[model samples]
Target: MSVPFALFTHCGIYEARVQDTFFVADQPLDDGNGNPPAGWGNPYQSGTITVTGQRAVFHDDLGHTVTFHERPGATSFLKLCA
Candidate 1:
């Protein structure tokens, strides 16, 4: 089961598509301040997603990872792609 989704953090927006064993993103992870961390090159890149329970872990190709926690009953203006 593969799911394509978008992720928005304090850093920036990312478009990601899930695969059989992993997921890939269309951009490099940001530093949550709208800038890439030190030693990062190219704004566009790919990554992997690891979902465990209610959390989603994004592992970037640059060796950086970010974890997002699920918020129950959270509301969003964005809609999932059909």
Candidate 2:
């Protein structure tokens, strides 16, 4: 099979690191359906993240914003066979 864009694995993604003009959010950002900010984006390196209620808003320095909310019951399950 080909590679998945989200790159989810057994360890799962735990953080979203931002530096200069780059950013990364390693989590199930939204519902499994097609959505923006579902994984990664560009030109959103430095900015601020505001969390209120069940929503998290990501604003970039370039005047762009991405409101993020994890899907309900979103999780990673691993099954290892020896």
Candidate 3:
């Protein structure tokens, strides 16, 4: 499959089903410890991601699959997986 474009929550992509794979492009700070400072565009990484069901699987450049949970929330913020 062709590589998907990078996607970040910054451009107001808060809540929705990612019907396909895409890249995160960067990684944000650990929100569990404290809130990320303003303008921290979801610093995950830039790579392939297979988003299906209620989760998003991130495939790094090295082909490592990192899974993340998808929660219901406003279109402005994302509730990290616990």
By lDDT, who's the top model here? 1
Return the clash pairs for model 2, or none: none
The Cα local distance difference test for each model comes to: 0.46, 0.37, 0.43
Question: What's the CA error at residue 54 for candidate 3, in Å?
Answer: 0.4
Model 1 misplaced stretches (Cα beyond 4 Å): 1-36, 39-45, 77-82
Candidate 2 structure, TM-score to reference: 0.36
After TM-score superposition, the amount by which residue 19's alpha carbon in candidate 3 deviates from its true location, in angstroms, is: 8.3
Q: Per-prediction TM-score, please?
A: 0.44, 0.36, 0.40
lDDT of 3: 0.43
Instruction: State residue 82's C-alpha deviation in candidate 3, in Å.
Output: 23
RMSD per candidate (Å) reads 8.0, 12.3, 8.0
Candidate 1 residue-wise lDDT, 1-82, digit = tens: 2123333333343333233222333344556676545555444335555666555666655576665555444443232322
Candidate 2 C-alpha lDDT tens digits along 1-82: 1111222222222233222222234343433333334333421234566655445556554564554444344343222212
Looking at model 1, residue 79 earns an lDDT score of 28
Residue pairs with colliding backbones in model 1 are none
Q: What is the lDDT of candidate 2?
A: 0.37
Clashes of each: 0, 0, 7
